[model samples]
Target: MRSFTTIFIALFCLGFVFGQTQGNDVLAMGRKVKKPKILSIEECKKIAQQEYNLHLGFHQKDTANYNLLKGAAITDWTIYLGIDDLPFAVEFLFAKHGLGVFTVVVCMRAERRYDILDGGSILMTEVLKRHPDAEAKLTISCLPQWFDTLRNKGYEVDERTPYRLYYFENLSSHFFVVFDLKKNGKREEVVIDLYNGFIQNIMPEWKTLEDLKRAQINFKPEPLPEMPKPKEKQEPKGKSSFPPEGKWEFSVTGVPGFLMSDLGKECAAVACTDVMIYWDNNGYLDDSDEQTYANDFCAYWGTNGRATYSQIYSGMPYVAEKHNDCYVPNGGGIRENASWAEAIQYFEALTQELGAQHPMVLNDYWPAPPHANCCIGLYGTGDDKSTWRYYRYDGINQLPQPLTVWRSSDQKWRPTAYVSGYCVGLPTVVWTSPLKGDENIDIGVQVQIHFSKKMNTSSVESQITITPEYARSYQWDPEQTTLMIIIQNPQQDLKFLTQYTIKIPATVEDITGKKLDGDKDGKWEGSPEDDYLFSFTTRGPKVSFTMVPSTHIESKTGCPPPNVQFTKFSRAILENKERRPFKVSFTAQESGEGSYELLVNELNLPEHATLCTLALKLTFTGNYHIDANANFSESIQGRDGIQITAPVDASVITQISCPNSPVPDNDWPDDNYSITNPSYPTPWFIDTESKVGILLNGFCAGMGHLLGRFKIPTVLVNTDLRILGTY
Candidate 1:
């Protein structure tokens, strides 16, 4: 909860030192002196109860919505906003079923924490706690002014709908964070990087488009808070809901334990930062600048308690790796909900194995009230593991001791571990193309590997080898977080329908010399101990005959005729109670009643330039004799062409149509809008990365059609995006 202003008191003393800031505001004496206008509890309560609504000037619908939960049973309270308690919350309240269909959770923290896009983290956490297994993955608004600004900034911006309208004021765009893969435990989603995996952004789904537009009228960003100072370790007072199955007396001196002063403080982030700071001081880091280097890595904890890997490591002055990256066993190998003893055993083994008595962070993943702490060192106050007084960061003391404070207003706390970001750990493979067990990969597809941390490029490159090898070219992103291996020399490409395995030796290390913890066992046995491996089988060389009608076009003389006979089908599916995967089945056919001439043309295999590509090679030879074929290739940027089908778990109205297929409904004045300008040309986008279906309607000839649909790869890859994974 410490302020940047307080942290920069040293800057005030230096007259000549130009303060470098990450904000648009200028510094006082070179450092930005932002004085937060935080109201007092009484002031905030008064405003929330009265003056706030006047400031917002809500219209009829909005005012009604705002007051729906205010006059009665609304749960209302105030807290410091952002990572710093800089601005006090006026009031955050949620009356069940007040806003929209998002009936379960409606919570708010700071102005910067609310999201106009996806529902925020608070909602996701609540949904996880309730549904446990539901995949919870935003907005109605307009922003012409904002779009113009973005356009001038060189973004290929054509539009920014459901955009934030205002900034600052009470209607300002709020702060938010996105978490992926699994950080909360097994019950929680997996925590992978942005390139691949499920993601959850702490967003609010209650506000209407109009309300959000009002808020984004002005723009203001959150400022950084200084690294919190650890206090003297104190035994926390209270009983935990979950009892310790086994007790262990332990003490680790010089453990930097910090107390959270703000309401939104994330315990695990605090504990992990403490460990990293301790590492810097204790020589565990190669480059130490007091706590500055550690602060650089842990700054996200103070802003909103969560950050993407690039958000945390990119552009930092110091190296992205450390002698030790606060390793977790198996990259969160321990189930988040594992018992205390299991977590202890894992960390204890990890610490002892590393041979450096580093502090460990613990989190319970308790959504209602998540708690975390950093354990300094292992010092048993009792004889052994069976008995020990636990001194935690929250100042709780736990043992066989029975202590209650009903007379006091102290809060109950849980000390546990989420395992993932609860501590920084060794690098692990976050995602890959032609995922393990994929039986239909393309022989010529480019393989991609996404790592959790920046890597020792040479260490990983030299040690990686593929079984049933093919001539391949290896390349990496600037950050070295992603690797792409292309099967080179079409003559030496892999065999069709053959399974292959990628082997990365355990000796591979991140930039700081930390070896890969492939098995996540938290050990460094070298060789096979931490080797990483995955296998995928390429698609067969032959085509199938199960295609269905997926295009709308009529042919005459082997060319498309003016009128239409092809039908378009679209449906909106929510919850997808059927548990269906993203798949569409369609077959291509060529038929007509006349002397037919069929022509075959050899098209190049999928290329990265087209993310969605149709692989069939047959075409109609004549003009209006009535030719018909199915091809749907779109997306020229070589990005994820098929992902355009639908967003993960989000409600979608999928419409299947062939490119250049006439837009249905007769909304136009004429069926042929280009009649007067018949030279106007229409084009069908070709998805070449994976595979797609394309139908060409021209005069008919003796022809045979293929039956099959494109198998869109979930990940978009390849620089040229030539061909994606095996289609």
Candidate 2:
């Protein structure tokens, strides 16, 4: 027993030493290897092909079938290659920074098929480890078992559905498995960690059938039958079909059956819901339910009773504002007294605009009970006084029924005798471009306004007013109901930094003569006469400057000492002149008369004139009138030394308005508002080219120091300005 124990210990020590040596050799090799460098596109393709073949033990010779795609993120590329005689393809992702192999994905082309490789990460790690310099740290998140697991979890995934397996790097590595749910056409994306098989998240990719087919790899769809061409024969001039013959009964899917509700008379609500649901199914709107939509819409329009054309027009904007994605143009109520011919025209227009046959909601389908229904189809024209057939939806209990109405000699339909009025829901614009209060508008910019209903061109043209107006032309898009005002000739290219107001009065009317009134105020002011006002400030010349109170000067001194000599002091003012300086001074007064003074140095005085200071008094603090000759007398040189004359006829004005107080900074009136921290710092200056004053405010702090700055664009420079104190 003792001899056996000794032999066991010896064997254990030998094994430990060998293990340590092997570890040390590994560390040495790692240290000797340099970091990998980025590989060229061709080199990466070659490496990927080699790795794939070496691991699979199959030589793929169809190099032409390889596709190289650059990733959306930088320094990432994928090489996709197909296997010979197999309905599968291999995708290799390479991180360009270190030429690292991120992942390898095998995708099958068969429907409902999963090309998951067991121990795919292990295989990748092994293959990458063959390179002495490579740092292989691969993880397989898309194993074949995941499909079975999802199926067990009640997810409908099949081989017929398209899927994608890709790798992404965001700080750390990750793998994604994306597959379509064949039952509902929704794409499911599952994210998993690269190092572990744990799922990080599962999200749905909202892609349409066409989008999926376009993005799917190796997806060759079956050809569709060609559409039959229309016959070349022209119909008789007076025998035209309103909806064309065959298209009268087109079906709209996903519309809910009409149901009576305590929520209110919901015919309009149901009809609107039908249109919304149909559009949603066709991928034009987000998913929504009819009850919730109707409830919300009724609440918005204040509809407690029977909905009318006025209410529909007013309420349509609210619907658009809430569900902008589902809002369509001309989708509001038609005119109350619209003629049958007019109604048919609008129906045809709506169908063409929506690119589908949409049902038209009629307020009074049955005259006896004042019932509402939808008109789905139309036939024949009023030109020949022929009978018109309307495919109507009465309720969910029955299919659409054909109602025939004879056209009288006056081009009127017989339905008018029983129905009081007609109303059809249409689309409208609840918003517009160049939103209100927009500033720095370009001089050459065209004005665009969107509307919910088709407008009467003549009415809209007459109601629009552009202040500081220019010669403009109008462009109307009947389909979009968008009015574009083009500046044929602007008034001096729109003055820079000047505000221009666009007024669209309530006089504007829609095609049905209903004035614009989106607010349902029982007033015309909401639409054509609603006094819709919007203004924008044109950008000033790039090179412009604004005068502001100088913070540095104001802080150090109070308005020029009451009686100090003007020549000896440095007056806070702006002087811009070639030879003679033009000085502007601001002064404040408590109760005494306002005054203006002019002083010139003896050396810079006019050659023949004597230099002397002149002062003029004003009665009030406001702007005073100045007459050069009346304000000052000619100069007298030393009581008769030479009788040098001064220029008294100069165009200098004696009226100098008392300067208002400097405007406070934006951060003023804080808890620490004090004289010690005067509202504005002195010496504020702004360049017009970069900065612009948007608003100026001021109060009297002392005499002659009006301080304020116009707000400017924040991007140009610092927002704060120092007002210079001047006297």
User: Which predicted model would earn the best TM-score?
Assistant: 1
User: Which digits, one per residue and each the tens of the lDDT, describe model 2 over residues 169-242?
Assistant: 11112233345453345545443232223332233241332232233323322221121221112122353245
Q: Give the CA lDDT, 0 to 100, for residue 222 in model 1.
A: 29
Q: Measured by TM-score, how close is model 2 to the native structure?
A: 0.25
Candidate 1, position 113, lDDT:
27
- The CA lDDT of each predicted structure is 0.36, 0.38
Q: Candidate 1 lDDT, tens digit per residue, 1-727?
A: 2224222321231221223333544333223455433334454344333322321222123344344323322233322222221232322332334321111111122332211111111122222343444221111111122334433433343431111111122221232211112222422211111110011222243133333323333323221212222211212235331223332223333544443332233444445555555555554455444344435445633453443222322212232244444333211223434455554554454334223444454433222123344544222222222212223343121111111101011121222322222234567787889787888786568899987667899998898999876667789998787899976664324555567999988889887678887877656677787888999987543221111122222321222443433221111111111112223222333443222222222222222122222322222222212222322221121133332322122212212233333444433222121111111132223333434323221100001111211223222222234223324
Residue 538's lDDT in candidate 2: 72
Model 2, residue 213: C-alpha shift (Å): 62
Q: TM-score each candidate.
A: 0.28, 0.25
Q: What lDDT would candidate 2 get against the real structure?
A: 0.38
